[model samples]
Target: MKLHTPKTLPYIPVAPGALPILGHFAKMKNNQVAFLEETQKKLGPLFWLNAGFGQWTVVVTGEAAHTVMKNKETRSDVMGGEGDRITGHITTDTVSIKDGAPHRRIRGAIQSPFTPKGLTVSEIGALLEETAEKRTSGWKENTKLEILHETSVYALDIIFRMLGVADLDLPLWRKTYNDFVGPWTMIPFNFPGSPRWRSLKARDWMDKEFQKMIDQARATGDTKTMLGAIVHGTDEEGQGLEPKELFANLRILGLAGHETTAATVAWMFIHMGATPELWEEIREEAVAADSPPTSPKDMERFPKIEALFREVLRLYPVINVLTPRRVEEPIEIYGVKIPKDTSVSASLLSLSRDANLYPNPETLSLERWTKQAHRPKPSEAVQFGGGPHFCLGYHLAVFEGVVYTTIAARRLASLGLQPVLQGEIPKPTYMPLTRPPAEAKILLKPNYKA
Candidate 1:
């Protein structure tokens, strides 16, 4: 399992502006996309920076990224747990963040529910379509709606319903969800009024809520909802999740499930608004479909819409970087030996836009995915990441995105409405997940229908 490395060069190149102790935290916080791109241009594919705690080596693009993602020695669990502070308080054994055998066992136990076969595509699609209609029903002509907030709320509501908790205090949960994620990228501090403080308070509330649901599901033997499945599921060893493990895993699902999809869907609207011709074609495809994509089989009807969804993920990856890891065992990649405990991350943002892999990388061209000649290699588009730890919810996210966007697009067209950008387009916030700014608006404008 050893990778060959150059005898002379032991470590990767370090990017400039290493401040005492704090490192490049300030620069990254200011504008992550710009900073990473700039550094890559200067330092080539792989470079290191100290994000305050320790030096982190980032694989920007090309073979280096593939090398890092494929290497099993670069274990994911060493950095932070799937739920971080929130879920960590409950248990660190959630499948999403675990490495090695434990990860396999937990993943095996939890994986079935998310598999393509396990999901009832038509049922999920129908539910999402209904949700989308309700969300868009209130929109009026010429009104400005913040795309991120609107999409976030829409996604949150749909996910809650899918979790079989639609009756929960959604408004309160929404507030809590925001607070829980608010401090993800901020420096950890727990004083009153701080993001960390508020997040902890939010986590406390959520922990209790999920625990109650778990207890109820166990008591009632309700195997219908996701929680019910997990509560009842067992691994290859016939071992079930402990109460803490179950609670933590559920929290991971709650946070990771909703936020990333919400961000991507918000960006999808922005891309659609920016490209009207493509939007029209997609809408027409949705309208001309044999029937709305109630099932995965029916999804084949909108190939163009599916292509557009892939393009959106490439351009704006919600989880820009997979969870970075502290290399517990030394690993060599790109002729450099990464020492033990050195933080290493594969930059999905950089890899998706590599000109070598994607021609005219900056352009939002759906043809790259649609056209056989232009499509990237499997390794190039690591938007959901690579290796054994690739996003568990990848399929579900795509299904939800395609189902929600296709139906929503048709509805918008029927109402003689189209998305129009309001003011200057705001840059995405670079947090644990990339999100469009809160003020990012898409106005519903009257479009003269043919």
Candidate 2:
């Protein structure tokens, strides 16, 4: 689709820096959020930036961000072409790289298990209980534990059960999955026998494992699980998904599901530890609700807990950048015209913390969401994104967040955990990525119920 170029020209110039060849790569690499914020401050809401070669990326604001995410004409090109160039290196079927009909078809097939309404709460509660028991089972008094590692493992287990792959060796699977996804966020260089290479090896292993499960499900006539649903599901043409497509869907589901949720949950715990007042409030709510400890249905009553999760997401979104899209037609956003085929991305991390939208954006206030008088509409927060490509797993993510946070809050309150105030948690070594701290520790003592 060719975009109409206006005679008056709407293209906004990016703030100038760097030599001809280097461009803004250095600034982006050093600290992506700060660099972008600095650029936005100087260049205004929508500005362009050189990101290698002749490619220019348009960084947009929150208002324009809503439009960009909802613009159907501006196709999600990242799922194909350039998206594939990067994601395909790790797994050939990475769902983020698939576009158009294929993307829709695959998403439909995989969404079957999630169709069982109200299952998320129950499932997540079960998983959280299992994780809590396992984590505290080995805890010794005064011993420091890395919550990030523990939570990462817990998140993976939850995802595995949700995907109907619970029987696999978790430690080995965790190691392999981490190795596979770890390098994808880094610069697109692959070294011989490096971590990236090992990740590729892991991807191959995962592909085979998924394929084996698919074959087993088909042979055994098991259509009860998500994996089975995908394997057995037929398209409009009444044909089952090809092995490659099935593997691609599973690859994306497995990788995306575990990593993002794990990071967010770990961050949530860290924030709770830092702010004990919020933690106590959550514990009191959960206890006063008098709801069955393990019941998912009862947990939904705690909107404060849910709000706390949203606050954390606002501060540290798991996927800091929105999925990139290419303009198919000339579109004006915040008075700036973007030409056809221009690449653009919404800075979700920046937007969520925009002082204009969120007052006192840096503070961790769980009640911010409860103050309906000050709350923005649901669409204001793009944590799960907007429009057609919005996260299919959003409800599931929220359910898990509520379950894990509620359980953790209750347990911590009961134990009278006194969090150590430290500097900011470890930032990702790679830009625009979510990596947990090297060691995330919290202290616990007996609670004096007030």
Candidate 3:
């Protein structure tokens, strides 16, 4: 496959203080948000930065984000050699990552399950309620547990149930998921102990497990779960996903369904812990609803909970930036000409925090979402992104967030427990997806429920 394109418009301008060989890799690893913010401040909305092996043009504004996310010219399929290697090892044929006809076909087959119409609200709510109750109860009142780790486990259970893999080991599945996805943003290192090495091994284990489930689903003609849906699904053309395609796309669903949602749930906890009033609001809403939300459609009934989730996404997008898009032909973003095959991406993190669009952007204002007039304009708070490639599990993720957050908040409140931050706010790991810092612990305080 072709790797190089004709030289792009004089490369997008690089951020200042980029070291010669390593470039901005260190800064990127150290703190991606601050690095991108500083660069955007100095270089304006669209600029380039050296990220170890090469340079990538970063787009920050809604307009530029729209340009890159929507333009079919900037296709969303895999890059040549490296992309092949990564997808080959981890995700072989994910529909969302595909660019052309294959993407559309595969996406069509899988899209139904994620849409509001297809999702079984009772099943989703039951799984989330079960998982949250089981996991949080394990944490004794007033104890501290790493929110990310706990939520990851919770997300895994809910997603696995969605895939009809309810019999799998939760802890092992969670670890494998983490290992496989941890290296997506790491420097390409193939050493025995490297992140890439661990990731590949983890993917192999997880792939075999999913393969077994797929085989069973096909054998049994089980159409209840997503895996069963894909196993027996067809596109408008009556083309079904091939086995390899099935494996890859299922892997994508598993990864995307859980990891990002887990991160969002974790951040929701962090934010709620900091603002007790928000948790109170969520609890009050839950009480008024008379029952916990059980499905994506049911979540619509809980506007306050939905609003809080929206605010959390706006403040801490699980994906700080949309997937990178390589220009197929020359394109102009913010009047700056980016030449053919130039690697480009848009930072959703930056856009969500745009003060011009979201006044007092840094503050966590749940009211901004609840009060119709204060909500961001379309594409302004791009938590799930926009255009053709917006997050496939957008609705499912929101439902999961509302269910998990509402349950957890109520559980804590019932225990007379309040969420309190024990240390400095964690700096998120902003690659692959934005993950909360493990060290940013939350402690439960008793008897402050108002």
Worst 10 residues of 1 by lDDT: 1-10
Q: Which candidate do you rate higher for TM-score, 1 or 2?
A: 1
**How much is the lDDT of residue 121 in candidate 3?**
28
Model 3 spans with C-alpha error above 4 angstroms: 1-8, 20-22, 58-60, 78-88, 184-194, 373-381
Tell me the tens digit of each residue's lDDT in model 2 across 327-395.
Answer: 777788886667777777777766788889789998877667787665344475587787766776666
Q: Which window of ten consecutive residues has the lowest lDDT sum in model 2?
A: 1-10
TM-scores of the candidates in the order shown: 0.88, 0.84, 0.90
Ranking of predictions according to lDDT: 3, 1, 2
Total backbone clashes of candidate 2, pairs 3 or more residues apart or in separate chains: 1
RMSD after Cα superposition, model 1: 4.0
Q: Arrange candidates, best TM-score first.
A: 3, 1, 2
**Can you give the lDDT of residue 355 in candidate 1?**
81
1 against 3, candidate with superior TM-score? 3
Best by lDDT: 3
Write candidate 1's Cα lDDT for 304-337 as tens digits.
7777777877877776656666566786766656
